[model samples]
Target: MSPSLFTSLDVKSGGGTAVFSFLILLLLKMAFDTFGYKMGMNPWPGVFGWYCNPAYRLFDFLLGYTGFLVLEKTDLKVSSWKISVIQCVTLVFYFAACHLFDKQWVPAPFILLTLVLIFAFTLPGGIFNAIFGNRVLTHLGNISFELYIVHQVNINLMNHTLLKWTGNNHLLVFFMLLVISWLMAEFFSLNPIKRFVTKSIYKSKIFI
Candidate 1:
């Protein structure tokens, strides 16, 4: 989305408009993804994809817009240590549920539950920084965008190599996959694919 679009939407204004946009954009993105996945044929790239991608990104923008909305609506300092503690407790469940489930669809209440908890725990001065804050997590978070894209490729390579090294120790292979994926994520973050996005956004007069 363009900066102007966000400004025009006043997505931070925190009321009915924000709520409606947030919900609608997310639904649209999900619908689009499902449609794409079901098409079976290779998706048309280039101009066709360029035009179609914003339906997905709007959902991403609304996610951030939601945090600001929550702050405005609640008017409570999320920094309260008590709130952060509560948030972290819920975060433990959120992580557990994510790790445990196949996640075709998360239960609706849990969706609301986890978002609020994550907001409280992760905001500045929140307990997440105090308890889980460290170099490893910070670096992983920094490169998370690249990590999502690059980790699987690196993991596949490592899986084969580790098979030879450990004679098919799946436990050790999984551990090494995590470590090597992080390293590869770091590498890609430093030398990124952002050039294409940068050029496209600038030429198209779109926002970051």
Candidate 2:
């Protein structure tokens, strides 16, 4: 995913290439999910099972690339209200699909999420600015990579150590984990630590 690679792929150019790529990746994901289910090899069943699949990871990366591609390539002049409405509607559909459907091999949720992300990346001025343009979100974005790495460990630690203290209140445990994770991410966001962590992550297979 370097600039040269993207240029070579010509993903930014208008054509059926991107669409075809997405379709092929989607089919691969479905195949992997079905195979994993049949073999009982997926430790995390349902939608979560797709996370560990190589095909799904490629789809995920392409989905994200599509977001940035849309942001850079599109010149839509729609109203902020319309964009916000689209964002909200897409999110509603995504959540509904996640809860109502068995996602063993379904791609509805991911498709909806892609719509949400595409709109989100192209957020215009006005209400969108007032909301997503805020400093809190900017700060969170800055430390997002750090959060991604530490948040899970923080959740596991809190579940083991703090859940009993909170009388097994999962909600409270979640907030505690969130606070600790954010603090850890913020601490690691310091320039020196951030650089080292980023270098290590890029060198390892853990980074997408």
Candidate 3:
């Protein structure tokens, strides 16, 4: 389903509905994983098989849609104190999950963070808004798609070619990846470079 069709149910006019739909989507995602596994269709855990599954991809797209819906599609009117409480509660739940499951609990952090961000959308004059509402983040957002596409390649290239420069420190390697990926994304976003690539691809008949 296209996100544009449902973009009207936004925070300003439909905050309750938006939150409810977001939760429902979360439940549906979990249900699909559970039933897909029971039916012998979902990928085995940690195998990366679900990445190729059409059903999983649909839910992924919906989640991404709703994620943006909560983040930027509407004008949120939540107070900073309430948002802070939500953040604290989410952190507590995340820590509890990690402790009980004896694992790193990846989804918990993302979901919890999303929840906090949904409410943090309109913290006027607040540090959270000030921190994220910046030119640097705007630049990153502009290149986010390119960054996603090229980040893995940059990581692999750095690991193979530039590890010596960092003395094999993974922390430094991580920074190197960030810088390289941002630079690569900026390069790809340049109009002349984008047109060149598009023309080359068209000449190769890739569009057909």
Q: Which candidate leads the pack in TM-score?
A: 2
Each model's lDDT comes to 0.58, 0.62, 0.60
What's the distance in Å from true for residue 28, model 3?
8.7
Q: Report the C-alpha displacement of residue 40, candidate 1, in angstroms.
A: 10
Error of 3 at 18 (Å): 9.6
Q: Report the lDDT tens digits of candidate 3 across residue range 1-208.
A: 3233355655342456656666787877666555554454645443234443334554555565566665555464666777656555655765566677553332424554554554554446454566677999978877765675677555654565677876778887888788888888899999999788657763454443
| Poorest stretch of ten by lDDT in candidate 1 | 47-56
For residue 71, give model 3's deviation from the true position in Å: 6.3
Candidate number with the higher lDDT (1 or 3): 3
State in Å the error of residue 178, model 1.
Answer: 2.2
Q: Candidate 2 residues 1-208, lDDT tens each?
A: 3224455446434675555555665566566556665555676564345454433554556654544544455676788788777667766776776777655545534654665565664567534566677799989977875676567555644576797898888898889889998999899999988678557764456554
Each model's total of backbone clashes: 0, 0, 0
- RMSD (Å) of each candidate, 1 decimal: 6.3, 5.0, 6.6
- Candidate 2: C-alpha lDDT: 0.62
Residue 127 of model 1: what lDDT? 60
Using alpha carbons, what is the TM-score of model 2?
0.64
lDDT of 1 by residue, 1-208 (tens): 5445566457445447667765765565455555555443326564334123434334444554553464446645554677767676777877777677634542333445556665666656666776758987776767865565555555644567888899999898888888777776666566444555545663474454
Q: Which residues of candidate 1, in runs, are more than 4 Å off? A: 1-21, 29-74, 78-80, 95-114, 124-126, 152-165, 191-193, 200-208
